[model samples]
Target chain A: EAGVAQSPRYKIIEKRQSVAFWCNPISGHATLYWYQQILGQGPKLLIQFQNNGVVDDSQLPKDRFSAERLKGVDSTLKIQPAKLEDSAVYLCASSSIKDSYGYTFGSGTRLTVV
Target chain B: SQQGEEDPQALSIQEGENATMNCSYKTSINNLQWYRQNSGRGLVHLILIRSNEREKHSGRLRVTLDTSKKSSSLLITASRAADTASYFCATAALSEKLVFGKGTKLTVNP
Candidate 1:
């Protein structure tokens, strides 16, 4: 089976600009998650989706960050008016209760704010 | 705040030696998972131990969870150069989110 897939392996944008990342989880997986990982830090959950419905978003910087998992198989995370602090690796992961032992993560999108 | 914190922020050891990393959490958890990240890439799932499990093993990896102590330890037996990577432990609380620790950087020299 294929692992989670993410697009735009790398991106460079200016402050106050906007960028969007796309993710496709492994087949038949119903739970999706978005995480932000700064250098030298563990990945932090930005949002989580269970079959297209949100399970958590409390950590998301709602004012600038938005995400959606439409149709329950794919997801997209957007950052508007990107800030220098928003520059980090965006990772997407998926899991299921029946297979909750672990999660499958994407290679991630490395965003550079200039 | 419920994230796990790994001890010995970094570790350096030689191949054929045993490597151990410890993690502590502050809240109750259903399970704890360990992951490995090479360089700045995505993480790879390693081992998962439930709160009820005291010890588990997979190949060269051994994980021990102590709910009473709210801590866990991962031991890689006879580690190899390929085992060099950043290791992280994540705790899954009631919120269903996997809170992760800062991670431990391990360097296995051959």
Candidate 2:
């Protein structure tokens, strides 16, 4: 089985710039998620998508961070006017429909804001 | 927001020894899962124990869950140098979101 796929394993940008990360989830999976993991901390859920609709995104910084999973297969997370504190790894994960277990994660995109 | 707290934020052990990490959560959970991350990269699922399960074992990893106490423990037996990584416990309720702990940094010296 193919694993979740993320693009641009690493990226560096100056503060206040905009950056986008892409994620391709496993085929047939209905649930997709984006998480932010800072150094020495656990991964925090930023948003979740069930199919083409969003299920949860309360933690997302709506002022700067935005995510969308269109067509219910691939997803993208964007950070505009990035801050120094936004430097962290963004992880993408997927799971089958109605499955609470067996979450497959991508390698993640490491963002460094200078 | 985090639902679980991992004990011994850091741990160091020699190869052939055993390593144990504990986690305590604040709310009711439908299941608990453990994951290992290497070099702050992607995570790999280790094991999942449902609320009804008391213990589960896979390869060298063992996980025990206590719903009454909202706590869980992960034990790595006969540890090897390759076991070095950060281990995290995540708890999930009826929702799809799984609340994760801060994680435990484990170093198994050869």
Candidate 3:
């Protein structure tokens, strides 16, 4: 099966700039997740979508980070006025079931905020 | 927030040796999963052990879950250099939220 797909494998932006990352989940997946991973740290959940509706976004920094899964297929994560601390790998994952099956992840977008 | 905590932040072993990583978490969980992430790559699911199941095996990977102790262990037998990567343990709670821990960096020297 095809794996989750992400674009712009790498991105570099100046602090206070805006950047967006796109992700296409695996076919037939109903749940999509966005995670942020800092250097030498574990991936932290940024947001979660069950189909097109959000199921969780408690960890997302709404002031800067926003995510949307439109049409319940693809998702976009955007960071406005990016901060230096926001430089990290943004990962996307999808699962056939919510919290039941294993997730299939995309290679991720390595965002560098200068 | 992170739920699981992996021990021995790093491990270095020679090929053909065995490497074991342990994870401990608080609160009750519905299941626990193991994932591998190669440098510059996304995480790949390695295995999953439910709260009811004590253990599970996939290929050369063995995972043991002890709910009573709130801990789990991942043993990689006959490790190969190709197996070098970061291993993470994630817990799925009743709320249906999956949380990951600080991963263990494993290096298998050939």
lDDT of 2 by residue, A64-97 (tens): 9999998999999999999999999999999874
Best-to-worst DockQ order: 3, 2, 1
| Model 2 chain B lDDT-worst window of ten | B91-100
For each candidate in the order shown, give its overall lDDT on alpha carbons.
0.93, 0.93, 0.93
Candidate 3: Cα lDDT at B23: 99
Better of 1 and 2 by DockQ: 2
Q: What is the TM-score of chain A alone in each candidate?
A: 0.97, 0.96, 0.96
> If scored against the real structure, what TM-score would every candidate get?
0.98, 0.98, 0.98
TM-score of 1: 0.98
Instruction: Provide the fnat value for model 1, as a fraction from 0 to 1.
Output: 0.76
Task: For candidate 1, write residues A1-114 as lDDT tens digits.
Answer: 899999989999999999999999999988899999999999999999989999999999999999998899889999998999998999999987778648989999999999
Worst 10 residues of 1 chain A by lDDT: A95-104
- lDDT minimum window of 10 residues, candidate 2 chain A: A95-104
lDDT of 1 by residue, B1-110 (tens): 43799998999999999999999999899899999999979999998898889999999999999999999999999999999999999999755679999999999999
Error of 2 at A67 (Å): 0.6
Every candidate's chain B TM-score: 0.96, 0.98, 0.97
> DockQ winner among the candidates?
3
